[model samples]
Target: MSDGFSSFAKLFSGYYSDKLGKRKEIATFGYVATGIFPAIIAISMSWTVVLIGRIFGWMGRGIRGPPLDAILAKSIQEKGFRKAFGMHRAGDTLGAMVGPALAFVLVIRIGIRDIIWLAMIPGISLQ
Candidate 1:
């Protein structure tokens, strides 16, 4: 599953991030990958295509995790780490809640495929 690939990607991505010293670029690439891949499923006509898209999307998420955390830690002072992380987590939680709620509403109006495409808009715009 995607989790397995994600775990594999995490192990190597951390090493590459350190070597490349380009956390921002790496994270951006990861975010773009995560954003674009799942949207591929919207065009899929088969379950296999859906599976591939999901796996790649999740791997992208895993790829971004460590580098993004490193960037976050570096951006904030040591004393403010707790608050910064709290706020970051709060934003993530809000997104998690809002995304599903929006999807639930939109799915009725736009249907599942269109909703997935709509979801990609925000993800791709993160850059």
Candidate 2:
């Protein structure tokens, strides 16, 4: 459900990025906002608060995607989009793989609740 709204938000985000010529501003803000969502969820005592956090996080992720794509495309004209995006996707996949691997190791020491803080490290760097 969070992703559903996020998917919808992506369209508008892409449009606004192009329309405003502010991809850097919009995407930077999205990264910062998305980073904070997990902390919000971890801190929430009520499911309602968690739900709100999820929605905002999803929207931030959605908003971040397209402009980043556009920026990547624009920045790498020499190599062409196919190569650049391919490398970008590889890194994304690597992160996805590494995240779980790290979690699997750290979960033993930290447990799942505290693992949320681990997720925040990369997210917090976006700001």
Global fold similarity of model 2 (TM-score): 0.90
Give stretches of model 1 more than 4 Å off: none
Question: What is the per-residue lDDT of model 1 for residues 1-127, given as tens digits with 9 covering 90 to 100?
Answer: 9999998888878888888999988888889888999788999999999999999998998899888888999998999999999999999999999989989998999899998887677568987
Candidate 2 per-residue lDDT, tens place, 1-127, comes to 8999899989999999999999988998778778888788888899998898889888888998999998998887765878889989999999889989989999999887688766777768866
Q: After superposition, how far is residue 108 of candidate 1 from its true place, in Å?
A: 0.4
Q: What local lDDT does model 2 show for residue 95?
A: 87
Q: Please estimate how well model 1 matches the true structure, expressed as its whole-model Cα lDDT.
A: 0.88
lDDT of each: 0.88, 0.86
